[model samples]
Target: MFALEIENLSFTYPDLTPALEDVSLQIKRKKKTAILGANGSGKTTLIYHLNGIIPAQQGRVKVLGQQVDKKNMQEVRKAVGLLFDNPDNQLFSTTVFNDIAFGPRNLKLDPDTMTRRVQEALERVGIRELAERPPYCLSLGQKKRAAIAGLLAMKPRVLAFDEPFSGLDPEVADQFREILDELVEEGATLVFSTHDVNLAYGWADEVVIMKAGRVLTAGTYDLLRDGQVLKEAALPLPLLAQLFRNSHEQPRTVEEAAALVEPGSGRLKAVDSSR
Candidate 1:
């Protein structure tokens, strides 16, 4: 079963600006999806619907085959964890440990269970040392990790993240990627919106591109071989793809591109006749 399914979904802002229009999507179970588009293209608006953050205005949204309505928002949220672009919006508790423990506490899990979950979450995010510190005192990156720990404490089956790498340093970003990989290995589905083409190109198993609050196209990495779609979505082709030139043999990462060109070579022996 798909982790999330949205059909003919539409939403408009309080100011009457259209945010999403007839957007339809299905994210498979145990898979990774990246939503890509320019600013104001509704990537965040679309993600909000995944976990009932925004009420369905004109269509249907199902989380793991269950309808997302007021009736079961609690159940739906337990199954799906959402991380916003700004950590400030999600972290409100005084202590980092308290923030992470809030969800389990609300669930009324046993004391030992709550503590175990909170400790695991902290270790998963590499913030064990900061557990007793106040979130107000943490840096932006630390706040981001603390926010993530909050979600991890819930043990959700699906994770929806908006610009998850925004506040992270390179090392921390790598740590986050490893965390995502570990989650997928444990059978969790991931859907995140990002502006980084290289990250999307190399990471996502599937990609959905949006334009003007509508889905322009979506599919596997092969979908990116069509530059017109990327252009239409106002996104640049991945840097590795641009450097490789030959679409037929494009590499998804810097290491993959390096494998094709020998070290100390003046230029690639292989040339794209199309270029």
Candidate 2:
């Protein structure tokens, strides 16, 4: 079943500037989907509509099977957890524990259950040791983790992140990647927006490319191999894809590219010239 289905979705700002125009897409359950676009391309706006953060100006947005509307806003929010691009925007409580506990507390879970949920969320995000620390005192990476813990505490079935890997160091980024992989392995739907073409090419099972508030294309990483589509989206071809494109062997990952080239060997040595 699809985790999210948006049909003919369109939105415009209060001032009448269009943000999304007739956008339609379906996100499968328990899969990793990447939304790629330049700034002001409606990636964030699209996600806000998923959780009913902003009412849709037109068209239908259904989460799981329920259509999102005023009456079902609470249920929709509980089922979809959105992590903002900025951790500071999401973390408001002084203590890490309180911030992580906020969502479950709103649900009026029993004290024991609330506490258990908060602790598990912290542990899952590898921030258990920072539970007592104030959010302001934590490092940027730590604050991001705490914010993620807050969402996890809600145990949402679908997790969406906006520019999640931005500002993260390599090690922390890899850690977050592993966390996402684990979430998918455990049957959670994952969707994230990013400007990093290489990262999206290597990691996403499905990719949605947007430009000027419309979807340019949506498909597997192979879409990155299309120079025209990449050009239209204002994104460059992934390095590995570009390097291997002419060889009739498009390698999506670094390891695959490595298998195609050796330092001492000729550039096209690994590529069979005969079709």
Candidate 3:
């Protein structure tokens, strides 16, 4: 079964400001999906429907074959964990360990299992040493990790993140990527929204581009090279794709881009030497 299925989904705030309109897509099970869009493009709104955070105002949203509705929300939430863009929004307990333990505690897990789950989550996010630290004192990156540890403690099958890399330094982002990779390896379906076109191009197995509350297109990283779609979404072509487009080489990653410009046996090297 698809991890998530949305058909003709639509949503609007109480003031009638449209957040999503006639959106439709299917996210494959256990795959990495990237939702790319500019701010206010409905990426957050769409994910909210997956777990019934924002009830479907119109159309259907199904998670793992169960339709999303008020009655099913608790079940859906247990299966899907969402990490908001701001770590502050998710971390509330005095200590990092308490924050991580909060979810499993809600599930009424025994003390021993709860402790084990919290520790496992802390280790998974590489934040075990921060267990005793207050959430208020942690760095933004540390808080982000602690927040993710909370979701990990829930043991959800589907994970959603909103602008997870925002405000993170390159080193922290790389570490976050490793955590995401580990989750995927463990068979979790990961869906994340990002404005970083390069990150989506390099990391996502499938891409969905949105604009003004609607999906402009959905496809593989190859979509990154489509100027028309990028233009419609107000997104620039990924730098690697733009630089290699005319050369018949479409490198999807930095490693591939490096190889494409290698000192010998690469046309780019000769071009560079001329300058």
Candidate 4:
């Protein structure tokens, strides 16, 4: 079953400029999807529509089979967890434990249940040690994890992450990606918007390219292997993709490229000839 569906979706800002135009897409259950676009491409606008934070303003938006509207607000919000692009916007509680516990507490979960959920959520993000520290004192990466823990405590079926890897060192970004991958493996439907093409290529099961407030292409990794979609989105494919483009082979991932590079394939042949 599809976790989220947007049909002919469009939205306009208060200024009357179109933020999204004729955007239609589907996020399949338990699949990790990367939504990539340049700024002003309506990536953030589209993510908001998924959770009914910003209403359709024009087209239809549905979550887990229910069309999003005032009537479904409670259900939609409960089912779709959005980790905001800025952790500061989401974390307001005085302490890390309180921040993580805030969501479940609002739901009126019993004390024991809420406590268990908060701890598990913290551990899931690998930030259990920081549970007592003030959120403002935590590192940027730690703050990001705290925000994710808050969403996990809510137990949403579909997880929507906005720029999950932004503003972090290479090592921290790698760690964050690993956590997201683990979440996907455990059956969370994930949709995240990012400007990083290489990370999207390495992590996502499917890719959706957006530009000028519209969807450019939606396809599997194989379909986006060439630089075609990336180029259209004003992004570049990873180094591996560049090698594959020059060689005319289909190696989507780093591991796949390593295995597919026969000794006679272009550069490998050149190296062998030089030796």
Question: lDDT of all predictions, in order shown?
Answer: 0.90, 0.91, 0.90, 0.85
The candidate scoring highest on lDDT is: 2
Candidate 4's TM-score: 0.91
Instruction: Please give the RMSD to the true structure for each candidate, in Å.
Output: 1.5, 1.6, 2.7, 3.2
Local error of candidate 2 at 259, Å? 3.7
For TM-score, candidate 1 versus 4, the one ahead is: 1
- The total of clashing pairs for model 2 equals 0
Candidate 3 per-residue lDDT, tens place, 87-176, comes to 899989989999999899999999999999999999998988999999999999999999999998999999989889999999999999
Model 1 worst lDDT window (10 residues): 266-275
Among the numbered candidates, top TM-score falls to 1
Report the C-alpha displacement of residue 79, candidate 2, in angstroms: 0.4
Candidate 4 regions exceeding 4 Å error are 255-275
Residue 230 in model 3: shift from native, Å?
0.2
Reference-based TM-score of each model: 0.96, 0.95, 0.95, 0.91
Predicted candidate 4 versus true structure: per-residue lDDT over 1-275, tens digit per residue: 69988999988899998999999998888998989888888889999888889988788988998999999898888899998888999999999999999989989999999999999999999999999999998888999999999999998989998898899898988888788788778888999999877777777888888989999988875545657777887877776666656464555567766665555643442222222
Stretches of model 2 off by over 4 angstroms after superposition: 263-269, 273-275
What tens digits encode model 1's per-residue C-alpha lDDT throughout 1-275? 88999999999999999999999999988988999888999999998998898999999999999999999999999999999999989989889999999999999999999999999999998999999999989998899889889999999999999999986788888888998999999999999998887888998999999999999998986576667889998889887777666545677877777666756875555656567
Pairs that collide, model 2:
none
Local error of candidate 3 at 179, Å?
0.9
Candidate 4, run of 10 with poorest lDDT: 266-275
- What would you estimate as the lDDT of candidate 2? 0.91
TM-score of 2: 0.95
